[model samples]
Target: MTTRSSPGIAVGVVGAGSWGTTVAALTSANATTRLWARRPELADEVNEQRTNTRYLPDFTLPEQLSATSDLADIVRTSDVIVMAVPSHGYREVAREVAEHLRPWVPIVTLSKGLERDTQQRMSEVTIEEMPGHPVAVMTGPNLAKEIMAGQPAASVVAIDDPRIAGALQRLFSTPTLRVYTNPDVVGCEVAGVVKNVIAIASGMGLGMGFGDNTRATLITRGLAEMTRLGLALGGELGTFAGLAGMGDLIATCASTQSRNNTVGRRLGEGESIDAIVESMNMVAEGVKSCPSVIDLASAAGVEMPISEQVVAVCHDGRSAKQALVALMDRDAGSELG
Candidate 1:
């Protein structure tokens, strides 16, 4: 197994989606990065062409980056393993990785969402599947296409261990990408998951032709809900106001590149949830995470009205306009309430 002290720290990223490929490309600039694609053909393309044509066609990956279809090949050789699979498949992939992962190799998850069945964070799933490995989460206002285009962006690496967190912040940082380390893993993960749900609500407002006031209201209230739930789960309050919370929330809600926002806009534009999901090539985490967020909120005795409306629209088949009316009709209360 490669070591951090070694000249070449191998980074194995186990996903080939747009965000995964972007991260692999970023890490390849500093480490011997290998991306795992489930499809052999996609691996071949990344190896031969240095481009993920299906997911990230417009950007070219670094020469140092390579692609592999064998999960074990990547897991067995790496010093640090990045789990980039979607939340739904995250546990299964972590289990598969554990079968061949080198002892003590840090596992960093880039997927943002809660597990539907277990309602567990991806880091929790990682710990359950592969104990003794240092678990971390990398998240922020990261948009794949923009980052691939070499735009300046920042992210947070949340882990309990200061040493491991420092190592990851350095490994994932690029010339244009700044990485910060935080100890509040729970806060960062919760912020990342809940923002996607809120982004859908923001997009719904946009699609319904609501003014900026409505969007602003959704974002502000969503942050409150996110902070409340995070605190209930033992997360630090400051973490919610940091890059992982308010920063990520704004980007996902306003950016055109956000998958969850796109899904919500489509829903607002009169498309059925099924049809919107069927048409997208990528996973919009908020759709699956909506129900789980509501569940978590209810368990914590937190009222997440926006997430509740999102669940209704995505699952209960409520119209976006109806959701809007319902929200506006609610009894007025203090802003802090």
Candidate 2:
């Protein structure tokens, strides 16, 4: 593990939202950290009050972590840039950063959702925008609030380049944060995207007031669906059992802190999707990721019943109960099948 005193490394975090702010706080032990927010006022708040009132309210930021709204300044100062923006804005953000990014500066994607229009994963979006640059994906059961509170957490950093993965492992592996490296970028990306869809399904279970038994079943079946889709896309089967797969599935589905869960809860309460989204300024990734996941599954010839139900509920206005009934009434088959 690389200590805060590690030399010759500076970190820049893009996006000043909850996850981005949390990443900044987690790495603040290293003095050379800069957080980029599109809003200058939010940046000033981080620099002056040491708190991100907009996203992570009431949590104090570290003094060592400075904030900026200038992409050029971020690119000029940091050796490693962490992309923490929402999935929808990922491509635009990557394009903006590409113009200013220094050569060979490794970019790590911390976003989990797939692009709705293109159905591309975060790493794919990054590679398209910034070709030839070293790209890595950091994913797992990482909750920004928990990480900021100094809780023990583990995550996988997937990169084909061992050196790039090792560098990230060194930079991000603090005493409270355990970082693992994997070569299955495809597996990691697919798992990361599909887990959010399952999280919505899990949330619907919660909304329906189901007990732990139902939750467990949804999560297990969700994992199966994720594995099938991932393997069909050339991902390693074991990757679905790791941090980016079942781990993320459990965390996001069970926690109220998850945007997808919140969306599902609201839907259960009879709130319209548009109203719920408009009221909450943040993005609920599952709502955006559902259609894309279904598309990907169809294209890859993978069976994803839970994901399909989520897409119907979120987009087609099917009630959560109806979706669950549909899933339960499906033709019975072997669990492994």
Candidate 3:
């Protein structure tokens, strides 16, 4: 297996979505990064054209980066593996990676969703499949297109071991992209997943023509529920105030680039879930992660009113307008309660 290059470690990124493609290209500047695409044709385009046209249209990738369709090639030829697949594909890909993955190579998850049936976080799902491999999550307010456009951004690398987290922090860190380390993996994962759900609510408000005050209220109150659930899951309260929580929430809620937000906007504009989903190529994680977040909140005995409304709109066949009315009519309580 190929190990470290002169300056940085070799990285194998599985999944060639917009975020994955952007990350692999960015990492290629400092490391030998290979991105794996599910389709051979897509892989060939990335290899020959140095671009993933379907995912990151009109964006050019670095020459140092490569693409492949072989999972074994990635697992066997890299020092580190980055899991960038959506949550729906995480397990199947994890099982495949496990068969060929080396013992010491750490796997970092870039997914921001939970397993539907298990309701387990991305890091937990990785460890379950690859028991001996170190698992970590890399997350923040990173919009793939913005990063690809070379706009400066910061993110957190969360893992239990400070040493491993530090090593990864350096591997992903660039001059324009700063990577911070956090030992609270739970908080990071929870924040990453829950923010998408909240973004949907925020998007619905935007589609319904709500003012900035309404948007601000959803964001602030959504954060409260996120912190409460994260705390119940053994995450640090302070972690929720950092990039993975507040930063990510703001970006997803406010930015038009977010897929979850777009889905919510369309739903609020009177599009049915079936029609919207059928027309899209990319997965809107909040649509699937909504129920799982509700499940987690229920298990923790926390009241996530916004998340519950999101679930109602996405899954229970409730109209977006109806969900908003229900949320607004609920009994009021203390801000911190």
Candidate 4:
């Protein structure tokens, strides 16, 4: 059921979606890396042909990368684990892996959404399922398709502990991929989750035929909301200005490839959230995250006007046209708020 740990560093990336596969492909070159796919067919495809056409169409997987349906092999063999599953599946998979992981093995999460019912952050969920294992979050403007294509990018690894952060940084860094370590796990994860919600709003502006001026204005205001919430939850202001915040916000808001933005555009074009979600194989986290984010803001006494409007449009059946009109109708206030 379990293989002996590699004498060298071995990394296990859970999930075989675009991001998971890409991370495996990248790290496999530096160390032994294995990707865990839920579907045996996808695992077989990756091992046999070095391609995951279902999720990563037209891209070649690295020759060093291998995949398996067995979570046990990964837990037994890996020195570290990177979780690339969607938020909905994060806790369940973490619980299962905990049964097999050795004590103190570091687990890094790439999930960028909050838990819906509890509104728990990814690290919080990990602690619940795998107590005492150091947890970190890797986030930035890094896009999966771009990274898989070997494009250059930088990202931050956020852990409260410095030593663990540095080790992860070295393990993940490559010629094309630069990794930075920050102690602001709170800031990084909070910003990572909220930016997806904001990108939806930005995309709605794009779909409604708004120009650059309007899009820029929306992104700026959205950043204001994001910073406000991040500050209340023990995050640094400087983090908000950096790559995990503004850089990530810009990419997700502007890119046609962003699933969240794409969903928002479809919403703007008069499609129902149910229909849009039904059609897509990938997860657009903002659609599920909006209500949870709004709840968190309410609990913190912070006002997130854009996220509230997104929830109304996506869940409460409020028309996108009406939502925009409503946002415009809000009482005038200080620019900072």
lDDT of model number 3? 0.91
Supply the global lDDT for candidate 4. 0.88
Query: Mind giving the per-residue lDDT tens digits that candidate 3 earns over 1-337?
Result: 2223465467899999999998888788767899999999999999898888888998888888999999898889888899999999899999999999877899999999999999999999998999988889999999999998889999999988888887788788877899999999999999999999999999899888887998899999999999999999999998899999999999999999999999888888989888988988899999999999999999989999999999999899998899999999999989977
RMSD of 2: 1.5
For every candidate in turn, the CA RMSD to the true structure comes to 1.3, 1.5, 1.5, 2.6
TM-score of each: 0.98, 0.97, 0.97, 0.97
**Top candidate by lDDT:** 1
Tens-place lDDT digits, model 1, residues 82-192: 999999999989999999987899999999999999899999999999999999999999999989999999999999898888888888898899999999999999999
Candidate 3 clash pair list = none
Residue pairs of candidate 4 with colliding backbone atoms: none
Name model 1 segments beyond 4 Å from true. Answer: 1-6
In candidate 1, how many clashes are counted?
A: 0
Error of 2 at 296 (Å): 0.5
Model 2 / residue 280 / CA error / Å = 1.3
How does candidate 3 fare on TM-score?
Answer: 0.97
